[model samples]
Target: LLGTVLLGARRFRGGRNPQPRRAPPSPTYRERGDTTESFPLDFTAVEENMDNFMKQVKNLAQSLYPCSAQKLDYDMKLHFLENSSVTCNDGTPAGYYMKESLGSRRWLIFLEGGWYCFNKENCDSRYETMRRLMSSSKWPQTKTGTGILSPLPEENPHWWNAHMVFIPYCSSDVWSGASAKTDQSGYAFMGSLIIQEVVKDLLTKGLDKAKVLLLAGSSAGGTGVLLNVDPVADLLERRGHTTVQVRGLADSGWFLDNKQYRSTDCHDTVSCAPTDAIRRGIKYWGGVVPERCRLAHLGEEWNCFFGYRVFPSIKSPVFVVQWLFDEAQLTVDNIHLTGQPVQEGQWRYIQNLGIELRNTLKDVPAMFAPACLSHEIITRNYWIDVQVKGTSLPRALYCWDRSFYDNSRNNKAPPKGCPVHLIDSCPWPHCNPTCPTIRDQFTGQEMNVIQFLMHMGFDVQKMAQQQGMDPSKLLGMLSSGS
Candidate 1:
């Protein structure tokens, strides 16, 4: 019982568990730290023993500190920026949702993800459809943080106690615009400015005393982190906050500048899309790139928008979390996935996309790149389940955090069994057992073994008919490669 409690306490205090699938043969009972006994385990006795141990611990804790029993509220509150110049696309007052943890000196500012509008037609269409993202008028007064921003300890193990800040995406500029409303566009694109203003506002609200600040974002916002992380650190340093260590966590933002399966002359179609979008949107939004990247690109500042292009210029440490087969990238490349099987050429193109992602992520010092076909991660409820080489995302993040501090203290290496750079080397999708379930968009049903085989460029229907067997029963003969 004491050994079990000690192990639990060690894990709670941030120790590596390293629970891999297979274990090597033990040398002996003494070497394994066990005292073998010949007694049958009693289910009722075990429960009673644990209950009595917990009760005793609880009583001792109360006697040691009577005031520790009181619970604290960690509900998020809405706060609008006091500055009038900082506004959204619709000219509404810019704001952010914050969940304060008075005891913690750490801060996590998360930028929400919504795709950008490149031109006036796109902005006009967005205002008509996704008004909530374009305008902050319809935003809820209060919200409960979930996923990485979750206040619950069970959901977010590492940063749950930190002060959480959720900045909604309202600028429609991929969080890089610096221009106000224009006569031609008739919408303010102050995304970069909004982030600056939020930090300035936070400085007056306990942020001045913060020790560690993690700037994180998803999708477009993730790209924003790459473009703006250094600027945030510069802002803090310029204002005399030199002690704070600023880091970035970008999720699903490592977009590749690759060619589509079918090239098209038209720029508006998915075959030739974001290339045109980035080229036009950079000027349309009056986008600002990092000084180092701007100096490097000179004539073409839009290159800074891509992760591989701008990542080299970023001095601050950042952790990239991207899917090997990103859904958004597939859609933009005109590779539409459905319930039906894909063509042979389409399968090859999809496989190349994963390879390209792996190649791009090779230099990233800290990242969790799983060979899955999904988009956003950090904000998903199942973020905990997704693993790379038996190390979950949360555990990888914990190890990365430790390594950062260890480096700051001039340590040579990270803790044993704690991996930071993890990537799925598998060649196919869903190759990792911890990969999330892939569902059909039209039917909203989980893809079964037949569909999975079909996705791998196999004509399962034809094979089943030829063998005089149902495709569903082929699971026994074939593996999903997981």
Candidate 2:
């Protein structure tokens, strides 16, 4: 009982449990001095007691991935690590099943969101976002017909030449600061795998490192870019490993300093997503551990980044994008009542979360563009938006000209109407994921969810173009969400 309570306490404290705050400097056991078991297994075992629950998730990853109908590769590479303080590994974990596609020109890599192992049955929200991206990208088909600001339309997507790599979120490493059931083990291990193996494979296949980029959705991607970039950049510097460009889009990103934005606390004691939406968040898309891991449930790790904050390093210029009223961030915490109007408290909760996250990261010059988008629209994060309605306006946020990026573009007009506020926008507030709004309700002509994401993505692409960077890289990670 004490063990369960302690483990539950950890789970309640950390977003993924098992990696509790207290420690004897031990990796995951309840007792800081206890080093009686393997690192990952001990930390993770309690939360993940292999009892029918995990087998189901493992079965799911295997079953869903093997639909030869999809013409996919199933087996994954594994690596083991052992050390007193093992922060870096040669890539790969001891027991992981990875997904990769061979003979494709475009590489689609999705970063894991939570510290929990990727095997969670509830993490399916990621799929909802990815499916939208792949289907909308219309790549693997023809790009010429994509309709808007499509730059690479004439270029071949080279689907045959492309190979995709899945960043696993679990590990079976040794002597590391992790337990099998702990959350850190999953995210850290998965990120290490992506950095070590996926990137390594791309270089090995003669793919230009500079051209390869990684994308993430509804997830943190563990910010491996923080660690991997410097070392990999060093490798690129020495010509040892080719440079692999990584772009991170943390959808409804939860990594910002959690104290301010970790959902409002009802009792001044505990924080939560929102009482009204927490339930709906679970039943809508099958969110498991919703209560235990959801924001409404509001555990510690769900919002803490002590590890990353403590080990701060600027790896790649990872673009951390978000939508204004994100359901995934707020709504995901609880299940919402079906027919009721969104309550005042719920509204405040959602609005505060977005503003807090946005303000926290605004001045880093890391590249930020917010639209009047909602939760996680596929097109919103991927497409580019502009003041496209009330009046004719030339693109200022992103122009082919280099001066535009240096903030030299004159504030052309008093800024034309955005068109979003004018129309019954299908996506706004919390409707689209990667939205940014200076005014609370500067309404204008509105676009559909897909339209919004495309608008946002196009802007990102334009930024890359002005900066002289490749756009197709990591199309999966950052191009979608809410």
Candidate 3:
């Protein structure tokens, strides 16, 4: 199945766009929280738009103008901070990858996401297992960008021309630590200091003249953005770069502080218990929180790690992009089975998770929340496919960017169709037609190779024709595992 899907992806990348044997069944919708009433989901317009977009993608693949040129200078160079005090968990010098675009004053600095280790036991275990994350010794000299970091204008329309910086997660601190290697801990954790040093270095490399600076991250990095967005802005203010309009874009980071579906002992596993782990991690990592948040929680600095707790304290304009049913959160919360044949109680729990997320995001000035069960956005090739209310993430982000500038200047609402606060109020996961197909290991409804390839932008009919088989027959055989 994987092989067949890869073949289709390769063919599509080669610029072929064949029609499918048939369009998938039309979707059904219900008013949020209204169980009795059902509505017909009209995807006629959406399909037309998607077809046009696929055509655009096909054209870009064939021409490859921006992609070809982008490849020439998109290799981000790795730079170790000169400040010796800033180091990764293994005492290795902390570093970030930078790709400078000449003639562009806008900057997008993205922090990479890797789940953190809060205590000495987990940190030690992390070093032996995921050494590359804990140390910078094996980081590549040059790395290419993708998703939002992509230099290609076709893929990343919003900030494609901007100067891009990719900060790897190495401190095991979620980019919030301020401690050095101690005899007792046996490791340095300077995640917070590393970011400050990176900014200071960029001052010499044209950041001083930047008109717009967007700080973005996914998962743990997303949480880091919430914890550090204001500080980064204040850092620039202190350095006299007050003209730089700093903003944040957090992806898949708004974790709910809700209870687990199946409670387990804190010592059993960190993946199944986040509250206890975070509580212990704050002290072990010497984590720093924004002043307002620290004061709000007083003694419980760990609350800063949760988006709902810290978002109220953020002063900068931030655009949040999150999956309504985040897979990572479900795993940690012990809500593992989300596929078909879901138990009654577990399904209710899943629905409630989406409700909680919607309620929390209601007050956020700018956001795009889809009714899906996945993690990480903004850096995916198919980000354009996922939309809420017919607005793609890029489109929503563009509007949010414009709204920020407009409101800051004249206090006007966003333009006609540009909606920044988009949340799917639908009850269940994958209710949105634009939502990606969910693949659960334990589900009875696993996608066949044809469906998988189709989701990946392949022409199923073309694949069937090339194999000298009828598309319908091929699908039948694959379905029966013949």
lDDT of 2: 0.33
Runs with alpha carbons beyond 4 Å of true place in candidate 2: 1-108, 112-191, 208-218, 222-239, 242-249, 257-312, 332-339, 366-482
Superposed Cα deviation of residue 89, candidate 3 (Å): 0.2
Question: What's every prediction's RMSD, in angstroms?
Answer: 12.2, 23.5, 15.9
lDDT of each: 0.80, 0.33, 0.78
TM-score of each: 0.82, 0.40, 0.78
- By the lDDT metric, which is better: model 2 or model 3? 3
Question: How many clashes (backbone N, Cα, C below 3 Å) per candidate?
Answer: 0, 82, 0
The segments of candidate 1 whose C-alpha lies over 4 angstroms from its true place after superposition are 1-74, 264-272, 448-450, 459-481
Tens digit per residue, CA lDDT, model 2, 183-254: 432222223433444445455544453344444343334333332434444444565544454444343443
Candidate 3: the clashing residue pairs are none
lDDT (10s digit) by residue, model 1, range 252-276: 9888878878766544324456677
Candidate 2 lDDT trough over 10 residues, lowest sum: 142-151
lDDT of 2 at 426: 26
